[model samples]
Target: MAKLIVENGGPLYGEVQISGAKNAVLPLMAATLLTEEKCVIDGVPDLADVKVMKGMLENFGATVVDDGNGLLEITASQIRTVNGDRKLVTEMRASTVAMGPLLARCGKVVMPLPGGCAIGKRPIDLHLKGFRALGATVIEDDENEQVIVTAGPKGLVGDAIYLDFPSVGATENILMASTMAAGTTIIENAAKEPEIVDLANQLNKMGAKIKGAGTDTIRVTGVERMGGSIHSVIPDRIETGTFMLAAAITRGEILVKNALPGHVRPIIAKLKECGVEVETVDDGIYVNARDKELIATNIKTLPYPGFPTDIQSPFMAFLTTVKGKSEVKETVFENRFMHVNELNRMGADITIENRIAYIPGGKTLHGAKVRATDLRAGAAMVLAGLAAEGKTEVSEIYHIERGYEKFVEKFTGLGALLTRVDED
Candidate 1:
């Protein structure tokens, strides 16, 4: 197993180039199944999740060529099967996104339920619901934990579908599936994430009629087939927010390059409230907080255009060092507070009542052995380690590698003292 060893480093100060959005690029790779022609995706991060998605695509006979840097040219000229890989499905949650593209391209798909970080319970009922609305028969094998979806005899016909919640995965899956359906499909209460808009743009370039992305209601008019197109993914807002927290936690300065200021408005607003100086430049966001007296602020996690839940853990780590009392309510995931105990192990005073984390700030945290409970939780541990007093060891770092690209290099560039080591 691999573990991260972190030591108390003084304030990090430097510019770090942000990687591509892991959340956006995964679905775009799945979208490659829509066309037989080659499609090129630029700005893709080299992540474990990306590699899993790449392996899944290749599992279905798609020719994927990664340019080592950040370019992936995929050609799905022939789909060998409609059956999703059971092993791949359990490795990453985004593997389920392949269901929509495979079903749309082949009219049949059998996939196991996806599994990612165990932060909370995320169900794929919405994805199946959207597919069923599009004239597909969905059968769930609870015994084997698999889902089988097959289009009707005449293929999929578009229909109006409403989601109970604006699930990003469901929205992308349904959007990709609807692109090649027979008629118009209206999805109400769809996800308004930038990744959804990115996928919509790529789908449009491939002759898909999609409008109202980045909104609650999306309309998709089906086409006979989708062609290939080249598209660049947007910068990772969650990653940008994480790096911003890094600057705040260590009282350092960082200019996060390739960050879209608009995508991280909530994070910037919250950071500013904590007495961190943030400036959005023409191409990047600069954060500086040396010797600043930080205050505690209440935070609530919500959907997009609101405070992102993905950054809740790491931001809470920052709050541990601030003065006064701070409260964080996580309305997104039930078990996201799993990191609270790990943070407490680091000598921080934190309590959870009714699932809300209450932190009394100004508590000195000494470095201690911790674990990366999940993807974002793993990052929170690293951030806390940077601000702690001694050496902190974080185990189960594979969770961090799934999302963050060049994790050690980026932090090292920003003057953080951390290294990856093997634990036997």
Candidate 2:
């Protein structure tokens, strides 16, 4: 176990380098499985989940080499097994992403239900539905707690699939599976996240034809085979949002480098709404919260181009240091409000009813022993600790480390005093 000890670090004043998108890199790692040649990936963040994916790929007999500096060389020349490791599959939710590539390449994939953060009941039904539409068979073995997917005799044949909701994972899974299908596959009501566009771009580089990636609809044409290619992942927008909130909470100035301004437009807009100064420059996103009167703001979590659900908790923490009241409605996940109690532990005045969080700002928050109930929640705790009156001991920091790379180092670079230490 690990814990982060944080103190009121005062106003931060420096630059922080944003890491590669953990979400984008995970799906991109899965994309490497679609080909047998060598694929080089750059800007890969050093995270636990990435290590798990690398191990999962190695489990399939793929040779993955770390060339340092966020560079990875992966070659899935031969797959030894179709059965996804039961232990590894249950460890991380993104493990399910390998199903599409395995099914397309090996014609069969067996994996247990994927496990991830307890944010919501993010069911794999959409993914299975898309798989079945692409001429694959899906069977749920409740006794063993695993899903078995197998391709037909003629393999996957593309078909028009419509998603009830724009699920990001479902969109990527279906898009990857349909790449080698016999015909054209059209996905309507697809997730329009920038990560999806990154996947489409990478797939297109690997000889897959995909269009309309950053929109509600996406089209993919089947090809005979796919070859490996070198690609660099986009910067992490969720991390970018967290850093922006860090600046706001501490009343500081931070120039977040390697950040994609377009990817975090919602956050930038919301910060400007709260009277915080945010600017987009040729290099990266710059946030100045020094001596500004940050105010309360109502926010509702939605998909891309909207306020992201992942950054909601961190923003809520920032609001606590402001003056007035704010409302946050979470429609994406039912259990995301778990962080509210932890925040309240730090002298925060927050109440929840019917998935709506009522937060009255201007509270003098004092640090306390808080547990990181989840990833983003952990980040919120860190931000809260930075602005709190006293020392804060944040437990269960593994969740934070799983997503954000060099988290403490980056914060410390900005003069935010926090340290990660091993706990006995």
For model 2, residues 1-424, the per-residue Cα lDDT tens digits are: 9899999979998888888899999989988999999999999999999999999999988999997789999999999998988888787899988988888888899988888788999999999999999999999999999899999999999999999989999999999999999989999999999999999999999999999999999999999999999999999999999999999999999998999898998899889989999999878988999999889999999988789999999999999889999999999889999999999999887999999999999999998999999899999999999999999999999899889999999999899989998988
Cα-based RMSD of candidate 2: 0.7
Model 1 scores what on Cα lDDT?
Answer: 0.94
What does candidate 2 score on TM?
0.99
What is the alpha-carbon lDDT of model 2 when measured against the actual structure? 0.93
- Backbone Cα, N, C clashes tallied per candidate: 0, 0
lDDT of 1 by residue, 1-424 (tens): 9999999879999998888899999999999998999999999998999999999999998999988989999999999988888888899999999999999989999998889999888999999999999999999999998999999998899999999989999999999999999989999999998999999998999889999999999999999989989999999998999999999999999999999999999999999999999998987999999989899999999989889999999999999999989999999889999999999998887999987999999878899999999999999999999999999999999999999999999999888999999979
Return the clash pairs for model 2, or none.
none
Error of 1 at 248 (Å): 0.2
* Candidate number achieving the greatest lDDT relative to the actual structure: 1
Name the weakest run of 10 consecutive residues (lDDT summed) in model 2: 82-91
